[model samples]
Target chain A: MNLPDRHISLAHGNGGRLMRELIELLFAKHLKNPTLDVQADAVTLPLERHGELLFTTDGFTVQPLEFPGGNIGSLSVHGTTNDLAVSGAIPKYLSLNAFIEEGFEVAALERIIISIAQAAKAIDVAVVAGDTKVVRRGEGGGVYLATTGIGIKTTEINLSMSQIQPGDRLLVSGPVGDHGIAVMLAREQFGLRGDLMSDAASVLPFTQALLDLPGLRFMRDPTRGGLATVAHELCRGTGLRVNLDQSAIPLRDPVVSVCDMLGYDPLYLACEGRVVAVIAADQADQALQRWQALPGGELARIIGETESNDPFVVLHTELGGSRILDELEDDPLPRIC
Target chain B: MNLPDRHISLAHGNGGRLMRELIELLFAKHLKNPTLDVQADAVTLPLERHGELLFTTDGFTVQPLEFPGGNIGSLSVHGTTNDLAVSGAIPKYLSLNAFIEEGFEVAALERIIISIAQAAKAIDVAVVAGDTKVVRRGEGGGVYLATTGIGIKTTEINLSMSQIQPGDRLLVSGPVGDHGIAVMLAREQFGLRGDLMSDAASVLPFTQALLDLPGLRFMRDPTRGGLATVAHELCRGTGLRVNLDQSAIPLRDPVVSVCDMLGYDPLYLACEGRVVAVIAADQADQALQRWQALPGGELARIIGETESNDPFVVLHTELGGSRILDELEDDPLPRIC
Candidate 1:
């Protein structure tokens, strides 16, 4: 912890004394575990012989490194792990890559690293390996994190878009657009401010609770393109029409108000900690009940269903009409994740 | 292949139609393999149950993205895989993360992706998972890459600094400082030019060749901080004095000239493709012969040896005088790897 500089410099990434000190004092100190060896080129992982291995990766470049409920550090961990979670796996190990800009505050870096450690510890996942690189000033965002997660799939059920049928129902674990709006408001670009926190927590519990159900077809965390994008994916993958009821979907008051004020579609906004699951029509109610029993799934609802052979995402209106939800083109928010 | 824009935009990382097209046409097309599933949130990997699993990660931020012998794309693959290689493991899978700046050339991106594919294919490794993010122009280097490699340790031999003893001999696979000087000259900051290509390549062949040698105590690729820094690491780790013979160390003419002109120490320069190994004195000549028989190991030499209990890296000058080689402080070359 004998860091001599308050701000990072190019030497910190030079693989020299400074780089070693930064990694040892900051990164390794925060993410210390039995599996992590700063001196070794690689660490060995212990795995069971029977289960299928799962691998997933994600990159986080959210603006305003610190957001309402989570920062890029915590979000990076949740994001990659959730990918494995929705795929019916238990995340066990993560490898982190940090791209830090020269001149960034060392204290801020420590805070983010601490956040990453806390989030990873919460889920019992260890950051077994990591690398740090420093980009020259103006050549990087304050910090960008990329995490690759390794997991083990113990479930007998195979969940995939190919498993979806025409009559399969769609259920959401919670409200959508909370993460997107929370980040936007944090930016204060439109002079908007709110106490809304991002719902950027792990979706492991929600995905695990329904794994025992034979009716579960597929599950995906609605991330960058949100609920409607997941709907579009289902349509494209299954070659079916997606019918979403606007009145049935759950939306928070603040998220709805912000979307209304900014002329953005809540359905297409990103949600970090939500799950849109495809379930057999007969078991949709049971899935909803199970999700609702979870802490973050109070607003769990059956919002949509797949039908017909056409590949279109249709949102049913309250006025007894429906409109097509086009695929995302222009980015409404850049670096949202 | 039907990309409309000549340059990348923010939408390409927004997890939308554009992102899908870019991934499908560029990344997924080139990196296609049986284990890679672009549509799946997480891909399943087939791993043997008996072998120890090795995990390693590295981040690449080399400026002028492309150099004489390689680009950041190829370097990223080699860098991460090399870590596993020196750890006495056979690299199997890799997960790539790219942080690209908006307004970058699409064609250049394609070339880099192709290089990545080619390099991975050369080593018979697969890029099973990946993620991409776009930073606003001026907020990032052209592109930064992070790769996490997963390999299985089939060899029962354990290589570590803890296994080192007095009288251990040191051998380098090839000439040093080529990669550092090559990248530096590529920048044209020193107004120097050369036909020297980077030594950036996988050290799998070198390390694999010596894994069967029971006399081999430890091996490391002389990367960012080069051979001298590695020697310092040996001294610090084992509390042993390292005696390096300057004349015996291999150094290419162009690298030596560049270092003399730039007033930089060749010992501290990076070598992306070289290996500095510690072997028992009784078997040092055997290890050297094995390395010299390889394609890029013509200059392989026994450069140094460990002796006594004092923790100092001493350079034995050709004049019979010795000087202590200090641990690297200032970074002469940043992002050489």
Candidate 2:
């Protein structure tokens, strides 16, 4: 049957054959991770040795449900896990809620559910408690998924605003704006893709690797508002200026070219797999070496440093002047993920 | 400026003066509740003595955010709490996520947030964490909210389908179909109302009250697809037949009348707050009395009893006919939240 009729019908939410099929066919193929196969009521998980727990919840309502790099299911898992990882927590269990449009394809529903299962498995998490509801046509676009995750804090991973001090080094894992640019490429609004690929990967292992090191003080995944916003949040509370060397940051040629074509700033565009980090000056090189050891983070670099000044994020340009990094004014590409 | 102007715009989601105003003026007014007055980043709450934790999450995307007796905010709090309560948990902490269309009214938003806070207060819970994002105008409806709650479980309370037994008497807390009928009236489809109001109260206390009665075998809040679907779930593993007396179940006059006009069954319609219990025959009268003592459960009744001979749900109709209760098939007034 033809899909994207632009509204959700009642049948989309039925939890029988249609719902099961929708979850299996459309969303699961890409998410073939193992933790998702248990099919339990709730995932009872193991925490770190004597770590305090941290839990975070997030909901996805992106239009189109399916995007260039991922769909809502995978995105929900990544988004919730990222929240915990960034907060220095080892994400272990997840709870989910799905709101389906009426008359949605059973195939599509199966795809989403399986995709969620796969994503959970990929990150060593389980889809524990869940609730599903159906909304009639015109009530919703397609499907919306909300995820809540509980994590245990790793003792050595003390990433906090209070940890920042003068002379701290900043770094990012891999390229930025790939996810946003790839989504725009999928839309084909202006045919702006130099064969871009969406950079959507679960960063739990990569985060755990950094936390294993002795000198790191901060870590965050640049997703929704991107690097500019993340940089601002880091600098806002410490009253320490962040002097970033723009030339040192990693970017793919296609991503930069597409941003030029779309009149968008790559700094504010989203990146799903990238991590922004702040490390002590003495340990910066070792941290960079550790990041470069990972497949996705092979191009990790020292992009900035903390300095004595008003809380500001300054980007040094090739033009021999410095430009201040500002908080993102609006989403560069709405529903890019 | 005029708000909820027939269409949600991009400006509504911008977290500027306009967004704050929309929340303060329109939404807060209708959602008028006391806990919302302080308007902090997170609400603080205290649990009852001996109260344990209960948790549940829900995403409400009903086609029309506004219905007869409640809106998404009211549904978010009550619905999540209902799921947690019936599981024998005392819900205490909540995390919420809101996705809004750009140009949604500042007034309407404030009203929704406040209403949510008020609802949580009424139920003696707190909203601990929240996130909000704005989607471009046409990409999203006015708003969608996801809430996750954490509550304590009492010392000795557990409700599950495995607790069911043969010869147990079935009891209902109050009238069925009021919520479903009220929402239908809100849609103004077949001109229905008067004898209906959304059964959208918090059912935590109601569920908790029955637990102290040692004879209470199983309890469930029948929401989507109503009491029939839940009963089917209860009877899944066990070959126990539930014989419900149709004449004994309470239904509002409006609900019965509307059901007749539309050829809908009251058992299939959704109920937000009412509950169903299976108690030993010896404790059925006391259970009914306990339910009747609570305002939310005043119309309590002994609707049926279980028999080992028949494993399905059979309704003993007012006309002395027997009919099996099948799972709800079509969308019974879809989005009648």
Best by lDDT: 1
Instruction: Write model 2 residue lDDT over B35-115, tens digit each, in one string.
Output: 333132122233343544344566776546666667878888888877777766767667777777666665566667767
Question: Please, what are the lDDT tens digits per residue for candidate 2 over residues A215-316?
Answer: 677787887667776787677657789898889888899887777766888887778777888888998888888889988888888999999888888999
The candidates score, on chain A by TM-score, as follows 0.98, 0.87
Please provide, for model 1 over A1-337, each residue's C-alpha lDDT reduced to its tens digit, 9 standing for 90 to 100: 4443489999998887888999999999999999999888999987776678899999999998999899999999999999999999999999999999999999899989999999999999999899999989999889999999999987486999988988999999999999999999999888999999999999999999999999899999999988888998898898999999999999999999989988999888899999999999999999999899999889999998999857999999999999999999888877899
Assess the local accuracy of residue B15 in candidate 2 as a C-alpha lDDT between 0 and 100. Answer: 34
Each candidate structure's TM-score, on Cα atoms with residue i matched to residue i, is 0.99, 0.87
Which ten contiguous residues of candidate 1 chain B have the minimum total lDDT?
B1-10
A300: Cα error in model 1, Å: 0.7
Off by over 4 Å in 1: A1-5, B1-5
True contacts kept of 2: 0.19
Candidate 1 lDDT tens digits, B1-44: 44535788999998899999889999999999999988889999
